[model samples]
Target: MHAKFEIFAAVAPGLELALRDEALERGFRKAKAAPGGVRFRGTWADVWRANLELRGASKVLARIGQFRVTHLAQLDKLARDFDWTRVMRPDVPVRVEVTCKRSKIYHEGAAAERIERALAEELGAPIDPDAQVVVKARIEDDTCTLSVDTSGELLHKRGHKVAVGKAPMRENMAALFLRQCGFDGQEPVLDPMCGSGTFVIEAAEMAMGLQAGRSRGFAFEQLATFDSNAFDALKSPAEPADLAWNFYGSDRNAGAIEMSAANADRASVGAVTHFRHCGTSEAERPQGPSGLVIVNPPYGGRIGDKKALYALYDALGRTLKQRFKGWRVGIITNEASLAKATGLRFKPTSAPVAHGGIKVTLYQTDAIT
Candidate 1:
């Protein structure tokens, strides 16, 4: 492999700008926003650091190579010439996935099969249908781009917090939303409808400068070019910064509260996080600096009747406006009407975000007066 290559850090569709900003801030000088992801140029260590540190990216893919191919014969020839030994191991099993768009090689299965045969015949690598290491081939505009999935599992897994609620906010989404709210980990955060405590736990982890992948393994560890010692250095845990109980979450369901608390405990953020059983109406500001209040409430269509949720949104808006003065708020929900029901004047909204299978938007308010 070349000493440097293009790295694509995939994120939630609506969060492309956020991830790009995050990468730039983290010193990825070449980071730029692209469709569905942020792209940067860096060495192998950069890939490892991205997987370890980026909280907003879903996965980090290293672009191995790309070429223009108009026919299956050209693809097969290029695949055979591609240097698979640079990234893939002959012993480690890998899966190949191909996507073709606006290209002459329109058959995805045929493209994948050609690449698989090349890897097996040239590199002597075993192909597994269910392997963690994935080689992705994308044929777009007659250009074939081959990349490796360095992040085995979705970043949100985090390997801690196995407990989840019906509509739990993903940790990656929570981190980006927190960034959108201008959270710097110096203030307290509250989630009145906290599901599985994603926001609170992520906030605590951020405050302590904890590496997001510290508790998990990565697919890069199984690759041929992987440096265990150098990667281990990256995994060296940072000292947890001294912090108080500034992160808090609450839910009306006892089961959800239990899950939140357990998740927090498993994440090792319990010391700085507190989970309680309370509805939005009962949520109160903690006795300290006011911070962000972010929530991903049920979309009503899935959890309850749309008509019934208006009252819930109204009560939530009223509670925050009445009590959470000087604090900012971010609401992620599908319906603009539902967000408007809050009666909280939000700043200009952004494009809708795809959460689960539904489209949601982040409604932010200037510091509540």
Candidate 2:
């Protein structure tokens, strides 16, 4: 195996800064921001740690090596010479994906064929169109860079949340948003419009110091360089702390509440998360110390008609303003008008974040008076 290599932690667009901070805090060496992700360098151990701990990344890619190629002949020659045995297993199958940009050899299909043939013929490894392990080949500016998708499944699949609501928030995005809201796991969290209890469950897990990847398996485990014993050691996190305060969630849909409770139970945070069926106007402040109230309410143009959402936002604003004193709020919405309808005085906004296809921004507030 290579002594050191470059690893890219892929995060959602507009969340590179948050992922960078998470990487640095996790003690990844020289974590720096790139356009779509954070780049760091480490050995295979660092790759395993990143897959297990980083919460903001959707997937992790390890840059095995790169070479400049002007033609398929050069690519074939180089692909055969590279030490594939160091990373890929002869017994397992791999899927190769190629993308070409601004290069003479712009035919991605032909390029992928040549590379796949080289791997199959020279390394004695099988090529399966559907495989858990992926090898990504990008030929940009005449440079052919090969990287392995160390994260087989997406990082957000924590393996516990089997049920999700329509337009549910991803676990990774929820973790980053909680961090953006200055949540240190010390404050209680409330999600008034909790769909599947994503915010409440994530907050409970964070407060308990749970590892994000504790319940799932990763693609890196199939790599040749993967150390099973070392990985087992890394998987042993400290015991989950006993939280004194509980997280709360309420939604108008009974199905959503049932789904939230079931998901929380599967996640092992059911004791600390309470889910109830109620509308935004009927959501009362739970009995607990004032903390953070974060919600991603429905927006028009995607899930509902825009014309009918104003009253919903207005009721949410009125409820928080009149009942939730001393609490801070983070509202995620694509339309500023909807946010303004809440009538909650928001501080200056942060950068717009991309959720699904819509671009949403987080509007935060100081302590509610």
Tell me how far the alpha carbon of residue 2 in candidate 2 is from the true structure, in angstroms, after superposition.
7.9
Among all windows of 10 consecutive residues in model 2, the one with the lowest summed lDDT is 235-244
TM-score of 1: 0.97
Candidate 1 has its poorest 10 consecutive residues by lDDT at 236-245
The residue-level lDDT of candidate 1 at 364 comes to 97
lDDT of each: 0.90, 0.91
lDDT of 1 by residue, 128-173 (tens): 9999999999999999999999999999889998888887778898
How many residue pairs collide in each prediction? 0, 0
Flag regions of model 1 displaced more than 4 Å.
Answer: none
> Against the true structure, what is each candidate's TM-score?
0.97, 0.97
lDDT of 2 by residue, 121-217 (tens): 8888899998899999999999999999999999999889999999989999999998888887898999999999999999999888778888999
Global lDDT for candidate 2?
0.91
Query: How far out, in Å, is residue 31 in model 1?
Result: 0.7
